[model samples]
Target: MYQAIVSPQEDKFIAVRAGQQAAMQLPSAFYAELADLTDSDGVVPDWFGDAARQAWGIELADLPIRDVLMVRAPSVLPVTYSRASWEINKGCNFSCEHCYLEQRPFAGLPLPEKLRLLDMLRDMGVIWFEITGGEPLIDQDFVPAYQRAYAAGMMMEILTNGSRLYRDELLQTFVVNPPHKITVSMYGASPETADALTQTRGAFKSAYRGMVAAAGVGLPVEVTLIITKHNVEELGEMRAIVRDLGLPFKEYGSISPTYTGKGTTLATQVPGLIGKSEVFQGCPAGHTSFHVDPNGFATMCKVGRDNPISLIAESPQGLMRLPAIADAQMLRTGGCSGCKLSATCRVCRPMARVYQEAKAPLNHYCQHGMKEEP
Candidate 1:
């Protein structure tokens, strides 16, 4: 019979081998026990009834609980989607000093190529599609590309600076067909700081207006604050603003050091910009998600997007063989090994590369617990 072991450290359930038998090879005893725990009519405990309902998504009253449990078998493969973020364009109108893509070369996949990539994602059963860039909205293909994915039954997410979302009509379109989530990069709370960082006068006002417009359309919005030396102290203040706006807050500790464009100069100017907390262990790129650049190069993280993994060929098995296809097993070492705060840690491959390149150890800018670490 299979034994359910609850991980004391992570609050997760794992099935282990029991009685010299593989968990899968065990007889119906395990399922029988589960059925007994979920049975009604005073046979199973009430507490276990709820647990069984959650795990199996079946109401006890709906079926012969014992017989159903015995006959039904759970799939061996875990239920998860291949998470991918596509950089639709490499150009941005705003030039934020802290931007990893600012002043970098602008490139975009041709329309035909983009469509092919979408088909590939659909075929691979990638339920989640994140469209980002220097600014994805700037691309002429943004609307069409989004529609393509939406038609393909994929849930979409977008990351933008909120500059191009100026008109009510554009905002309305997003509301009518809302994506899973929309994240806006808020450079600063005030126009002065924002303009200074973006190196664009009056751009902050446009961005703010865009965010307000987006909110009016009933689209769920999240504010992403990129923390830097110039804005680290204002994080709490930024959180307050996000709360006031009725939006979720997603704070990035710092820009990745491996990022081309203004990142190189910014890192040099702001030494110790990153927080020193080793909240996360190693890179969680492949484990949780993957990134695809405009050129169709897939990688474990955005920083590594330019470095090619295998190309997006038309086969699932071939795609799985790509070096950038991050799996849970691949992320168990290096920065993630024995990490005390792995649950709350955000250190991914990009951040680790930044830490290694900038400092011998993890950078203070990106860590939560190592704020005072040398």
Candidate 2:
């Protein structure tokens, strides 16, 4: 039986997946007719959102049409990803003390290999590509890798440190075919403080020059501030610096210590500024988005970079099954069990791995809600 459901945003018919069966596009008239027959409760039912493909054993031709707007169809929803972050390389020119990669090697697949990986992502229907790295622009293969993504009609978001963007060659390449947007991380307000934080000479100047050059070239630019003790005192001034740049600005206060799940390197940050309950809200990792490390292992996000499924081994065929893959990796554990903070908790499988050794999941990972040592 055809059950009609209207789109929450508009008076449009909701799309239904026929699954392995024939594809079905329930017409608007179907919904209107169904509404006339069924009891109308003005509110849109919760099941409306969960609706997907029609169930098995129900022959499409034989089933009679029902005149109810909200027909109970067993939702066999398919998982489709709209955005993906590709950590092209783990290499960076500068050695920022708090780098989540924790000074991991600057290694990655060669240009030809990376392009093949990009092909897999494109075929799998990833609409948005967030090209990130230890610092993407500095990588030797970045230009070619980016060129391939642009050619594929993917909306590309570049995450860079702004160290190399000032060069005329790099600037020209970007101008030739610009990205959707470039997000630059603002380390410090002054050259001395910034260089000190980056632990490299002339880093602040180079990064600043590159950021400004991108803006001058008319490429969309965005700056984000990483709140660390090294630069926390100058937060006001840092915001002012980005403000003068006349571009969008964002602030990130949380610092995850271990870049990879292997080591216990602390990427320290400001104390008690952000509360635990305030921070551990629901995460969209498996739900709406996911990330890929330099090695092509896909995970829900960088925070929990473990149990990454190999993109190389699985694509188009297996990659199309990400919804099931993500659902199976659903993040929940005894650590969060019985805690009042569970309702709004964003702690997931990756984070659980982060503090697995410490055995104090919430206190170790969360900036707030510090519990005393046992």
Candidate 3:
């Protein structure tokens, strides 16, 4: 495995180390020169060695390019997105009530097609990649697909439930090729509460064991405390558990309807814990980042999935339409079209539409509901 990666992040070129924040900006000419080199070439440019030494305190002058660094192939496509998230599969071992995905189908592209999808992502110059799922680690092709993307120099992060993190196979794979981070969701501190929330017997034991195992091995692990009505009382205990484990944790109390506008998931929301979201600001969902579903359809983001383009059928060329698609979805259409408080509305137009479609209570997302807060 290579120690560093040289790739394009939008308009700029950078050399970044996997699992580390260390990075150095590279000149456009230097990036061009590296991009021109064939993948089989073993030549290590002299400037890279000096720069790497100066920046990261590593010696690479005498090593072959392939041995020292993975030089990512520059893209010729008009779109220059550097970040992307992939849903490896929508299946999970535990069935959580507040999951955003209404349907947790155990299906995705076959291994060969999954590899092709990874290739497309690499060709699109995606440097920061997130592999998520109902539980990504449960997927059969996850290891091979992960290895492929990591080899291609994409700094990867896995969003998982941590139920399978204790598995030796996964630990070995992660030990070999460390991901930039592994984020695990903590539902509750106790088995009774967690199992009830997830509707799975022994769910807490497996997940807690996995988190402890992963942390014991020194994997880059972070915890997300999923606060809901079922487990809200255990908030302090969950924080104490995470603190004992010596892992960073973030609390998430707000819940939203399913991506397909199913409102059932919102019933689990702890209204008292739902904090007001920040005011709407512009984002770079399509211009600098995108999300890919299990079947290889690319959308601006996970929430604003309007017109998805098939990355498998059209390949990277289809990305040319993404920016326009993203921009169109951002328009305040429907009920929000002529709203006076559009500027101060916390939810984006696409999210607001979904909330409306779900027939959710106004206070759940709309500014109208926020104004009624006591």
Regarding TM-score, does 1 or 2 come out ahead?
2
State which candidate, 1 or 3, has the greater lDDT: 3
Using TM-score, rank the candidates from best to worst: 3, 2, 1
Best of the two (2, 3) by TM-score: 3
Which 10 consecutive residues of model 2 have the lowest summed lDDT?
Answer: 1-10
Against the hidden true structure, what lDDT does model 2 obtain? 0.64
lDDT, candidates in the order shown: 0.59, 0.64, 0.89
Deviating ranges (above 4 Å) for candidate 1: 1-81, 232-237, 260-273, 276-278, 281-284, 305-307, 310-317, 323-350, 358-374
TM-score of structure candidate 3: 0.92
Output the number of the TM-score-best candidate.
3
For candidate 1, the lDDT comes to: 0.59
Which stretches in model 3 have alpha-carbon errors above 4 Å?
Answer: 30-63, 372-374
lDDT of 1 by residue, 1-374 (tens): 11122111111222221111122222345445544444442243343345445554434433343432322222222222346788888788888666655354577678888888887766555555789988888888888788787655455788898897867655755755567678899877777777877888987798888887777666767888877666666667777877877877777755554364223535422355444344555555654456778878777667654345544553334445444445432454555568566576655544555545555334443344355544
Q: Which ten residues in a row have the lowest lDDT in candidate 3?
A: 35-44
